[model samples]
Target: MRQGGIVGPFPSARERLGNGAISQSANDWEHRYRRTVIMSDTVATALVVGGIGNFFGARDAANWHEKWGILAFCTELLVLGALAVSRSWAPAVLGQGADEFRRLGRALFTATVVLALGGIALTSRNIKLWIFVAIPAIALVTMTARYLLRLRLHRQRKAGQCLRPVLAAGSPATVRDLINRTRKFPHLGWRVDAVCTTDGLGLDEDQLDGVPVVGRLADVAGHVRRDGYRVVAVTSDPYWSPHRLQRLAWNLEGSDAEMIVAPVLMEVAGPRLHVDAVLGIPLLRVSMPTFTGGRRAIKGVVDWMGAAILLLLFAPLMVSVALLVLMDSRGGAFYRQRRVGKKGREFTILKFRTMAAGAHGARGELAGRNEGAGLLFKLRRDPRVTRVGAVLRRYSIDELPQLFNVLTGSMSLVGPRPPLPEESAAYGPDIRRRLLVKPGLTGLWQISGRSDLPWEEAVRLDLRYVEDWSLALDAVILWKTLRAVLHGQGAY
Candidate 1:
């Protein structure tokens, strides 16, 4: 079963160790852990299918024969079984990133395809009605259930529950960085319980980055067995050659501990990464950044259409905001500031004016009191903002006028933040990448802490969005923007 010291292909400890007692304990715990996720999904699927079936069955008694009802029940069970086989309830992805949602979507698509083929084989016209009802009902109900479960997982993690104990193995610096990141985002659910260094370098100090140093790299396997650590995370370290990692992975196998290697690549989204096997070597492949194509064209159309619809819906509110702006200050209802747009095109960004008529002129005098990131200027209690302006800025009501700019193609519904001319002038070559696409009314920065982000973080997010533009990602950002505005976490 061994291939150059790599762990066997099977994930089960019993297959590797042949120790009935130890493997049985691991299996039981894993079973119980997986049960919660599986049961939740199972209940959601049953409710959606049963509810839809009963409703439609009552509506048309002639169509809902006993045989047809039995067929519907069997079809629902088959789809549920398919979802289970796809590992939609896998514990590794349950409370984590977008993988859970992605898996759910893939499973649903598979179910649809299977049902379509089955309907064709059976020559049944009623299957069309079932497909239409089941797809939306299953998708809505299952996604809602998973989101609620994720919220519970996050709450539990905050209270220090449902986290796997991790033993970090690497150099002190990488281990420290990994530990800090784990602490900062506890919802990812890895708690660094101990550390093991290359040569026990920091063991004398007893701790590194708040995690206790237990042993040298050679003692990692012994520590896992002794302390019952569930995960061993190996980050970048000179001592961890391929052979060394393979040997480590082998030793940890069937010990109730899983080994995970964290690549040094940072902040790259999952969509951009793939693993390629070439000549028995595992290589990480990063896809080329996409900037132009059919999708981009579709995005442009969506931007214009969505902006027009929103403007129509919010016209009354926009008018109310304009009146408030005029009553609170002696300025025009609308303000236009020169901003750098796509490919360095300068545009006059529109907004309901939130400051006095001469506030721009007074910006120079308050430069010394600037509180914003990099070249940006901000103040918690600016003298320029009118009383009404504060409320608008807090809830982002002032930015509604930008829908016109979106319609005009000067901005997008979701993209990087539109920079001021001054900010763009100071941008380095790397930062200029943000100008690759049209600037946005809202973007990653808006949903991810907004004005509270540091200059470097804000720039990074903008560049990331520019490099990895997808309509799906845009939809996610727009959805999050609503939550962000409601919470008012970092708004001015």
Candidate 2:
């Protein structure tokens, strides 16, 4: 079918040509960003290697070239070589996700192992300095540099710059869902400029959400070739048969556009999902979520140690907050309430008192005023909240005492949000999956809009965490928690 006939009215040649500019601009920024990362990594590696070599080899300055310079040069080359081999500088991973840092870490590890093996093979004593200190320092500096660069990229994306132009193809409902998600999380860097539904139309005849309806699903590759979309996202739909999908992939070959097929299982991701080929057919294999393992043991150790250190560090602040709470409200310095934990166990969760003495008793009277989602009860301007409590809740200072809970093994530093007894009692079988792991002091719910998210969204995030829990994911949540606490957007 003709392009114009597939869609109602194709864009004029000038407009079609302008579409390529979006792809060009995307390529330009991505290229620049990757180059910048390469340069940063090079400089960071050099600085660490040079500084260590010079400081340690200062006594034999005359023989430094023979003794240290060669090793230093070799080390830098090895590090860079490892990064290239591991695809650390790939444009696709440069500015998003944990994969960029994960690759960088793997590269550094490879370089370190090679250096250690080389040192042992050569019987070199001085190599210990590089192994013990220099490589670690380089990792720190390079990771920090990459993080700063990512922050800059995210800022640009938030401002509607430096985003991949996407052409979504699916049923209208699924395509619209994809559109909503991209707009909600702009930092993921997708901007759906056009869409192609199964029928070459949407709920609205010409457009889906705000994106133009370009053509039918069959015309997706043609539109992508013509307009140069950076990403062609294929959401799940009955129209996409295995043979048709293969044809689509074949058509997308040689084009700059990357085709991403969304799987039927949406909530399960990360290390649990793997691709395998069985009987000449490619299959998406999902491993069961782990609840008990060495990793969980490490998580427990981290929770205990991390909570102890934080408790010591925040001791003075906690005391001050307690005193203020006592002064501002008719309650004890701390308030303890029973919350359901892992395996449906009940534990007393502690926090600084943030409400009047009889706030729980007064809950029924204000039931109609609840602004919370799901089983949560929230009030943005609850009269029962003490003056000091408002500030404490805003910065999440009231929950500082939860470190003791973490220290005592009643809660984790990161996991699902602890539900109240009534809430847990009301949980359906699917929601009961949250009880498989210990409740968290702060979780995906905390970092992802807290009380501001809808009940369903809150549950979805929790389930996702339960499904895809990992040490790396926990670290990310902890790091983001500081920013979320500082912003205090959804705190009631």
Top-lDDT structure, candidate number: 2
Off by over 4 Å in 1: 1-34, 56-75, 120-123, 294-316, 468-472
Q: Clashing residue pairs, candidate 2?
A: none
Q: What is the lDDT of candidate 2?
A: 0.87
Model 2, residue 193: distance off in Å is 1.6
State the lDDT at 129 in candidate 1: 59
RMSD to truth, every model: 6.9, 5.3
Count of steric clashes across candidates, in order: 0, 0
TM for candidate 2 is 0.91
User: Could you give candidate 2's per-residue lDDT for residues 5-87 as a string of tens digits?
Assistant: 11122232234556576567667677777888999999999999999888884345354333788778888999999999999
Candidate 2 Cα errors over 4 Å, as ranges: 1-19, 54-71, 123-128
Question: For residues 1-492, could you state the per-residue lDDT of candidate 1 as single tens digits?
Answer: 322111112222212243333334334434554676677777877777777667664344444333346546866786687778788877677767767777787788888888778777876666775678876788888777777767766776665555667889999988988888888888887778789998776734878866678889989988887656778899888898999888888888778788888888665675788899999998888897777788889999999999999999999999998988898889799999999999999999999888888999999999999999987899988999989988889989889999999999999999998988888899999999999999999999998899899999899999888877777678668867988898887888
- Please list the C-alpha lDDT of all candidates, in the order they appear: 0.79, 0.87
Model 1 scores worst on lDDT over the 10 consecutive residues at 2-11
